[model samples]
Target: MDGISDVAVGVKRGSDQLSTYKNTISGTDCMNDGASNGSDSKKLKVDAAPPSRVLHIRKVPSEVSDAELIALGLPFGKVTNILTLKGKNQAFLEMGTEEAAITMVNYYNSVPPSVRNMPIFIQYSNHKELKTDSSNQQTRAVLPAVSTVPSLSSDNQEAAGTSPVLRIVIDNLFYPVTLDVLQQIFSKFGTVMKIITFTKNNQFQALLQYSEPAHAQQAKQALDCQNIYNSCCTLHIDFSKLVNLNVKYNNDKSRDYTRPELPTGDGQHSLDSAVAAALRKDSSLLGALNPLSAAAVVAAGKVALAGQPGVLLVSNLNEEMVTPQSLFTFFGVYGDVQRVKILYNKKDSALVQMSDCNQAQLAMSHLNGQKMYGNVIRVTLSKHQTVALPRDGLDVQGLTKDYANSPLHRFKKPGSKNFQNIFPPSATLHLSNIPQNVTEDDLQLLFTNTGGTVKAFKFFQDHKMALIQMSTVEEAIQALIDLHNYSMGGNQHLRVSFSKSSI
Candidate 1:
């Protein structure tokens, strides 16, 4: 330990100060060498053991742990001990034998190892064995190296390469693949830093960033040409020229896994208020709070809309059930539907282009995550401003040729009254003031004749309120206008508005 001194002295300090400490220890060693008497005890034989089976790592992240270091080395061979110089962001990892150390060094020396995206330089340590002192032992949390950090090395170390970002394109998009779905898929290789989903050339495209390029390469190789669900969402992968992805919004399309949020349906309530509401009412009330009508919620959500494009990314359809006409039948309710293109490479997904962003936003906020055809669909503002149909090939045949002036469009239809009293459209409509004995079929019949097509109908547990998912935003708005304050039965005045939940 001649060149090393006071490993514990600067454990809580930074790297620059630790360098100065090392210089001081070097000066002390030189002085001791000059002052030493010619004693036989000080002399050692030349045939001492070679360097120990330890690898020295430098430039590590300060937050990285002993367990993480063990995880890194465990793939090559058994790890014997770990010494962490916390403040300096360095460590010495001792493997079970010198051969193990050589294997680790030769492999990672040409390509460096990384933890948390920070590249770490590795070399052989001179020590024959790590010293286990009480102070150092007390400071570290040691675990057997047999276990692995699933996030770090689910694949071989060779796949944990140097680049950190990957660009992924869905060749065939049939499933409703959300940012959450991509995160779940790519995270097995390494820590996923960020993911951004958008539509390019009418296809679902995404950018995924891992902590290291090797992880990205591994994920790309494993998932390329793989289907997300039942051979529909085929993945096409490549290395991004950019080293990292910049994510500014935590919206439907972009997610940074370094900072993750709660699931999709759980955003309506705060922690304290949710508990309070649960205590006040039955636990069922804790599911999703609906204080305002769906129209009001849609109106509120519009203020945050980027107003970027008419294109909408639709997800979560049953590939077995969703078709170009089915998408048109639903999205056409909100605005003049221009075109519908079912992505050939993805399962249960399609692109619906409206005449304007207003209609797209109206449709997105209302119908997102609403049940249709036995599956809940998720809709979001696509990064593409419009759906550009392929100029050549059979894909163009999937486009809706005459959607602009189609009779199916609510406003363009003959004698359509929706133009005068247009509320912000939503798919889920809230209906209150219902008679206790009234059934779902009765309410469905009332709306189907005037409001629009009914996709789903469900009464609240109390039977006084219900949520109805109309086929389109216009229908929900028409129903809201027609039914608000209308008589139901026996002094009951019906109150209807757009609902927040599509169920």
Candidate 2:
């Protein structure tokens, strides 16, 4: 009876051990399943936040402006309104539609927010839309942008009814499309008879009369939907009902092509007394305004300050990309480039002397801190009055006729075979048929300033041929696209192509 009791106790102990082992396996499985579900729940939290149209972007770089914010949204969709608190490092952007906002949020959230080298964070705002002051908005009703070419469309029979009188409405008003700019662009189509600029419904509208209706049509067809320079000044042109544009007055708002008083922007122009007085008054009031108003005034002040003349020191340049002529081309856009001296002591730096301090200031304000040839161009006033030219290297003095003549004018005389001619981008660009006067630095300057990083440069035994190595295949392609058939001095058109062997 005692032996039977011992066997029964041992069996009871074995049963308890089996139970404990089963419990341990069950707890471990529960933990493994919980961990997987936890990860899924986190991902759901990110994806399931109810899609919102309005995004409240936080942690924005303080230096970021409203324009930069608008630019960020441009890739996704049209941005209706942008409010930036530079001091607070936050911004609110209103997209054209809800879908656009959602798309932008989804894409950016998955990635990271970065602008101007500053990391940013974007999230949905509690408010569906941003509230803006009606008084603050520059409510202008400009002409609507024509999406399709109605004039050239087959369905429209009136396409042939060209009119010499063209009513030009600038599609984009954010750009400072001035009277002189219109005259220069329209002049290519035909002799612009006269121009009158007026603000209608808060939009910039202009009346341009050409010598012939055919010329007006040609200009409209060519320039319509095309940006003037960079990307801002888009032209939306149409034929006017009137046969001729009347020029009743000669003032800031109107300019007759026949009038000699109109400035050609050749560094000889000055603001009238009335405009000057208004600017001075506004400058005095800069301290009292809010953050938004202050930012606008500051930008205006920069342009106004650019009118001052002095020597501008440009640094942080890719030595392969910078050249005296390229510097002349860029700075000349703002003011007259009197002289350009690439520093021999510092090959990566240079000094550009503008005609006056105003021009120097303007160049510095616009071109300073801008990316050129994979580097931010550092523009500042030089302590020395002028840059001393090196005896050995090339120095550009006075304005090149191409630059002094017009703003961003390339490929002069339309319909030249050069218009259709194109050279694909490559890593190593082969250059031939170069002019004797054009130095290696000149060629390098042309490529780098126009979005290229020169990795290597070589001239063959034949001085006319040279090989330029860009930092990447894409940069080489851009150089080839921009410089092919480019007139270097003495009627020499640049011959550019890709080299099979990497230099």
Leading candidate by TM-score: 1
**lDDT of each residue in 1-503, candidate 1, tens digit only:** 11011111222232332333332222211222211332223322223234568776666677765545555564355555566665445677777778767766765755467665556666666566654444334322232212122344555455445457666766433224566456545644555677766643334567778777776775666555555544344566766555666555556666554443324322221123332332234211112112131111111112123234788999887888666766775666566788887777786788889878767865774467566665667787776767776766656546434366664465565344443223334678777779988888888998888737999888889999899988876566556555656678898877665444557
Instruction: Give the 10-residue window scoring lowest on summed lDDT in candidate 2.
Output: 139-148
Backbone clashes per model, in order? Answer: 20, 17
Index of the highest-lDDT prediction: 1
Tens-digit per-residue lDDT, 300-371, candidate 2: 112223223378888997888676676765565455666677766677888888766655654664455555
Estimated TM-score per prediction? 0.31, 0.29
Candidate 1 versus the native: TM-score?
0.31
RMSD of 1: 21.5
